[model samples]
Target chain A: MLATVDQHDDTSPEIGGIAVDRLRSIIERVERLEEERKALSGDIKDIFAEAKSAGFDVRTIKQILKLRRLEPSAIEEQETLLDIYRRALGM
Target chain B: MLATVDQHDDTSPEIGGIAVDRLRSIIERVERLEEERKALSGDIKDIFAEAKSAGFDVRTIKQILKLRRLEPSAIEEQETLLDIYRRALGM
Candidate 1:
């Protein structure tokens, strides 16, 4: 029965139909991930704006985001700098 | 004349006036650097848009920019990836 399904080029058997369903599921998963990514992007933008309004440079915020994603340690270094700056400014 | 001017705490000598002028120049230079930074930021945004239109993720572009700023070699790595992707896509 499996051989017969494989032999048919145009209409394969139901058992072989799993591949198509799997492909559809994969595409749907990718679509959902993309949607989630868009939402996260908006949240990041809001954070940048908030930082900018607080007298922080938005470019630095963007850089910090990138650095945080690529190098977690870099973020810690930046936080240390922020702490020092705040202390110096008595903030 | 210089001693007389320096003796007056309120109105310092012309020789001491150079310090005030130097401080003004430093402030002006910083202002110019800030303006240039703003213009460069807009240019980077445009580059991100171009990358997005080319099917590249803007988030990746932002990361690339950050990495490039922090680690110059990272940009080369990204360019290598771009080259491989382009070749694989036959573009």
Candidate 2:
């Protein structure tokens, strides 16, 4: 017997024998996290504005942040590709 | 004369001697990338839905994604702390 197919709750679907309340709770938790994520993104934009006002190159800072998130080997591979592209472009 | 202070373009502010057009271009590029990121997040959510329909544990998959993004030492440290917490709770 598939619990989800029984469809007792219209709003929340159950999986296995999991209750509708549990599924709704999971959805609510994900929704709350998403709200927090959006707020954090706005905070990040404010920090970028602060950095720009301080004469920092926000674009370069963003690039550095992306590179730092990657492993060293991945960064090396990206640099190699970048160098190749630069040479091909006669830069 | 600070290029940003002169405020030639009301929409886009310049930094140093950089043109307002160039600054606006950078901002537009970031905005475009953010749009793509949102689309990718939607795609990821769809994948999670598929996984759940197939009876897979979405939470464990998310945890695996997070652990894979971290360095080995960071994961180990996290696991160590998790174990300590579990033991404290008599798990």
Candidate 3:
């Protein structure tokens, strides 16, 4: 009776034929990660603020961080594409 | 003894004078997040593969996902800036 009284969950709600508990676990983990990511992003924004105070372009720093994650060949390919696009646009 | 060998941990490795255990916890948590992120990324790539098989442009989908996270005003500002840039370049 106590267990029944305390349990309003799982009447098991399934989503798209997936087991609800498993789907809920995945959703919860993703939500948790999103929260942590938001916090870490605030930390990153603070670092960008520090960089701005030191007279650095935070946007370029952001691009640099993005580029650092790419392979050299990938970066070269992107740059070449950008060059072509710029030339085509008369920029 | 088993206890002695098992207990050899803090012999505490410090970095930059920060408390070693606290630093280790932060590093370990970040490392855990990185690992989970990598795994979740693979899941996202699988979804992208599914999208590609369904004849969707994944890069555009990625951009849409990015845009969805932005405020409407921010999106408008970006569009305006892009239009200005395009006009400036004779695009």
Candidate 4:
């Protein structure tokens, strides 16, 4: 795969000279990163399944993901809600 | 802006007929949504500044945003850390 990438880089010089090389390098790096991302995603899915098997509230996990996407203040609001929920449960 | 958008839509009908109208509507909707997004972003940033002035750990808020981008299991890990942090601080 690396050899193929290097060969493609060599013959594709007519595309845009050095800029094409740079773009190719960036695209290759991104492709590698995407593969790593997919692997990590699968690992996370497995962990969630494990947690479900262990009887944790999976819905709370989903909520955590949703809250995590918000801005800082929004996250603080979510944390406050979590605190309230924990307190109400005497945990 | 709405008038300009409508005029553009009317003149651009040769681009693709009904599909052009549908595309124009979608683009107009997106433009409006983008304006709303900017307003909301400004509001959230102001809220964060206020929270910082109130002496909250802004890092946690940033972390929350980062975690929110992750999958469910990754979010669960972040919440576990938050739970531990809260308990340690006696909050």
Evaluated with TM-score, which candidate comes out highest? 4
Deviating ranges (above 4 Å) for candidate 3: A1-91, B1-31
Candidate 4 fraction of reference contacts recovered = 0.00
Structural similarity of chain A in candidate 4, as TM-score:
0.50
Which ten contiguous residues of candidate 1 chain B have the minimum total lDDT? B12-21
lDDT score of residue B3 within candidate 4: 29
Clashing pairs in 1: none
Residues B1-91, candidate 1, lDDT per residue (tens digit)?
1112334555432333233333445667999999999999999889878888999989877776677586667677777766644443345
Instruction: Give lDDT tens digits, candidate 3, residues A7-33.
Output: 345665545443445334444444455
Q: State which candidate, 3 or 4, has the greater lDDT.
A: 4
Q: Which pairs of residues clash in candidate 3, taking residues 3 or more apart in a chain or in different chains? A: none
Candidate 4 clashing pairs, residues 3+ apart or interchain: A68-B68, A69-B68
Q: What is the model-wide C-alpha lDDT for candidate 2?
A: 0.63
**Candidate 2 vs candidate 4, DockQ winner:** 4
Give the lDDT of residue A88 in candidate 2: 100
In Å, residue A35's CA in model 3 sits off its true spot by: 6.5
Per-prediction DockQ, in order? Answer: 0.03, 0.03, 0.03, 0.05
Residue A47 lDDT in candidate 1:
82
Candidate 4 docks with a DockQ of: 0.05
Candidate 1 ranges beyond 4 A from true positions: A1-18, A64-91, B1-91
Better of 2 and 3 by lDDT: 2
The C-alpha stretches of model 4 lying farther than 4 A from their native spots are A1-15, A19-26, A58-91, B1-12, B18-22, B54-91
Tell me model 4's lDDT, rounded to 2 decimals.
Answer: 0.67
**Native-interface RMSD of candidate 4:** 10.0
- Candidate 2 has a TM-score of 0.40
RMSD of each: 15.8, 18.5, 16.5, 11.1
